[model samples]
Target: MCNAEIDPKTVPHMRELMAGLPTNWGKWGPDDEIGCLNYLTQAEVLRGVASIRSGKTFTLQVQMGNPKGDPVWPGRRGAQRINLMDKGDFICGNGPQTPGCHEFADDLMIMYLQGSTQYDALGHVWYDDHIYNGFDAKSTAGGMQKASVLPIAERGVVGRGILIDMARHRGKDVLDRGETFNHHDLIDAAKAQGIEIEKRDILLVRTGWIGSFYRRDPAEFYTDFVEPGLTFSRELVDWFKEMEIPNLVTDTIANEVTLEPETGVMIPLHCALMRNLGVAFTEIAALDALAADCAQDAQWSFLYTAAPLKVVNGSGAPVNPLVIK
Candidate 1:
């Protein structure tokens, strides 16, 4: 549906962009309103086809934090928090004294996205007055549902994947926090890795920042100037927008720029990626092992699966994402 009050010239390529999205089984009305058909007869057929394809799937887990360990943070104290606790307790009982089983239990704080490796939907963030899928930021404060909200459940992300080792590109075993990664650096890494990004692909970035924080002092890791993160640049945003990628995952604290000195702001990439383009993001993914495996096999795509907790209007969820190659 087109907005009559809004100037069509404002978004000269709006039609082209809309064409790129999947088919809409709904109707458009005046005032830019959309109404969906209650139940489509063809929906079941399409779902059956999808289920058939999903039967032969592979998966890999990309979580890093141990349940018995402390949570992973950026600062020195934060670093120590990871795996600080020991294996705690177990509840064992017998079923009518016939058999006994023990369930090991511990207070767990996981740092990875979606309980493990995961993706952040475009509805996760907003900028100015715009959100993912071109939703109005004002109307979203109350928490929009489905398309307006981050549809982590609806959009099953199964596609090609690419990993760019930014740390290796910079000739460092690991990167510290506050380390800036520019758009050019990303481009160079892609070139060096000999990977060509394709539309609807999942892009994975390995900054090595996770490794540094995992091994270094929390204070130093958080305050250090060598931690790798995606730097905010118009060019980078433009690149992703032009590429029309679907999802992005990274082995960093956040998927985008953090703590800009000049602007004193964090999450510049958040606004660009989540707000402008409807691209999903995931952070703190355990990618080192996966990256190593990929490097050996020269393969990137895998059966990637992540399911978030069903929390109402939650800003984020702890996920345990696994990739099966």
Candidate 2:
């Protein structure tokens, strides 16, 4: 939360900045937890299927347990994998026996569910004692009793994903820290790529931040810790609602700039887009490969599908989204 460049005293609260914005609270139903993902209907799935031209598939999850360490939000460490049993245990005569002359290796991982590329539950963030769909924030007291990632996983997200490579569109390998863009910027990038972002399309915006993380030292990457991405604006929220955009996938840890440049509020879009509008967010996706391929062939639209782990009551779940072109 320590952004050196911005003065905390001058920042407005999320509630204050998001006042008067539209919400999708009852747009689906009172019992709804999956939110705007409902827009990925059967016809949307077929539309995604129809966008396939080259039959090339790209997996968008970053590698977990990389020796060089994984890219995650500051203050959160990378996944740790520890071996429980191996040949050394058997040689030491301390291994458990299953059958005659049988040996096995076992390992365990400790990580934050949101430490990797993940789909955040609508209940993942909130203000004013309520979560998405106006569910009592108390439901999250003991691990998200409502609007957890389980419902989203059960529903699944499959639709036409339009890639807006903002970094490439701006003629840079990566956007500068704290660089901000809006719905108009997204449209401009799409237009530059000669494609249109249609209604109900799963929007994937790449800033190249995640790719740069692996190339630079962790300390340098997290210094001041502001990410370049979509900024908060009433018009941006209106655009998302008007376009019926279902899911927002980005390569940044938080989908938007670390702090809203206008109000100096942090992650206001998380509340405006997820809590209010029920828009699903998939963060930390590895999109460089996909972006490169799209640039090579000039095909930016594809069939995007992701199935996050069904973690009951979990705030978020890691997912390896599959994009087919």
Candidate 3:
């Protein structure tokens, strides 16, 4: 059964824990040092903000998995295409009536994972048995009511977004896959881009990985090529906590520290951001067009908006985020 209730009394210590935190803008607060976890809900979101000055609205979505084509990831099952018409005859008046509308059907595969494109949610990752904002991972997985089950309403996200062009920082158009990015490299790139990180700003990092994936073969995109990603570090978390950023996103496969082949450990960034600080992360965002615009205008911060699909009990959903300068 769904527990459609928010009992602050049950978690009294939570309120006290968050009491010392600054509550600026109330509902429409910007990302802060520790990051804003509760601000994603409808009750705390800002609604009806002023219209965006820019008139452009671009969409960002990845092509779903294909059955006949190569698999998305190794060891994963290939997609399956189904066509209702091919299974049975369209008409059989004397013996059995064929399934209605079978004649007009087509074969297609459904995308099982919603995180294929620009996506975000609380259930996407977990640490210490807790999901986002102290939600128990076991309870949440067992059907307890939580933010993961809720819809990403339109008002939940409305703020200024900044894009850090890592490719530009390297003096190249893009970075290849398997290229590991470190903490100091990000700092240098930010400096080179002349972009100052700010509180409540949505940070978008571009490595040109997405562009490479689209242009090259699937094998080349996944195995032959890789790109630089933010390396997880305790100091980086402290910096974000001090800045009070609410959301952090990137145009990469996973928004965390890429595991070092020598050490063989997963993203430490997830540990610091999601577990320790409760900062939200968005992955696989398409920001090439926006990056170009920012380079031309010499401005990074812009009004941003994203609306995720209303999938119940879903880990994450595909999103088409927009930016208005």
Candidate 4:
């Protein structure tokens, strides 16, 4: 990990930094919203089903309201659940009356769509006044009018997922703060696990970062606040394009190193891969148990399916991805 302090002036603009990368703008169609998700064809669905050796399943979403506080990006509060109706309310004579004497408990949650394990809309981040499929940045005013998560939620994501455990490959419980890895490192880690990342596979990389968040102090966790994840590079972007990787999932707040060490750019991949190339990002997933099981059984591939809450014109949506191995 590079420890150099970042200077805002030295960082290049996103447009200048991502000058020559190829985009997926007209590949699908003029009205395409969900991007590389088109790669999950019927055959790809069958391929995922074939990888299901056992009946065991894992849910990749973290608990929404942890007593110790849920893990979230700085400045965004975690999900807050407040009871609207409960036995206590009935006891206090404040509950709604029912003709048949039926009572129920109800609660409401307030949170950022990206607050938990989530699927980011293709328009979630952009520069140069453009989003995925060249949608105007103005469509995001008030709410997303193009490339919103609703399309993704309606379509759903299902495919063969390959887990690349970076921490285990590097012999660490968790990668250090701001630790970075690229496509080459990903390939090496996949090789070490005796797995091949097939084209169009849902790429799930585990850095053990989220696992450590539970054990460490919240203040310390946010102190230098740098997530260990894939760093932006031209070759890495090319690899993703060539491989047709649909989704990139990780156990980090942001799916890439917070700041590019060399260019001092914040989440360049969000602009390069997501905005330009149209790759879906699933972040802050719970991959500890799944990684451990894969390590034990030596089965790194499985069927991955996720349907984020359908939110109209939303920038992102919460999701609880299901993994069957």
Compared to the true structure, candidate 4 yields what TM-score? 0.96
How would you encode candidate 2's per-residue C-alpha lDDT over 190-222 as one tens digit per residue? 999999999999999999999998899888888
**Model 2 segments beyond 4 Å from truth?**
1-9
lDDT for each candidate structure: 0.52, 0.94, 0.56, 0.94
Q: Write the per-residue lDDT of candidate 1 for residues 183-276, one digit (tens) a residue.
A: 5776788777777555444677887666554576655555544335877555666677566565677776567656544344556566555554
What are the clashing pairs of model 4?
Answer: none
Task: Assess the local accuracy of residue 19 in candidate 3 as a C-alpha lDDT between 0 and 100.
Answer: 34
What is residue 232's positional error in candidate 1, in angstroms? 1.8
Count clashing residue pairs per candidate: 30, 0, 14, 0
Per residue, candidate 3 scores C-alpha lDDT tens digits across 139-238 of 5654434545234433256565667888877877777555666556766777777776655566678887665566667765556323467764445656
Residue 8 deviation, candidate 4, in Å?
6.1
lDDT of 2 at 300: 99
- TM-score, every prediction: 0.64, 0.96, 0.70, 0.96
**Which runs in model 3 stand beyond 4 Å of their true positions?**
1-53, 65-109, 140-145, 149-155, 182-188, 224-227, 260-263
Worst 10 residues of 1 by lDDT: 31-40
Distance (Å) between predicted and true CA of 118, model 3?
3.9
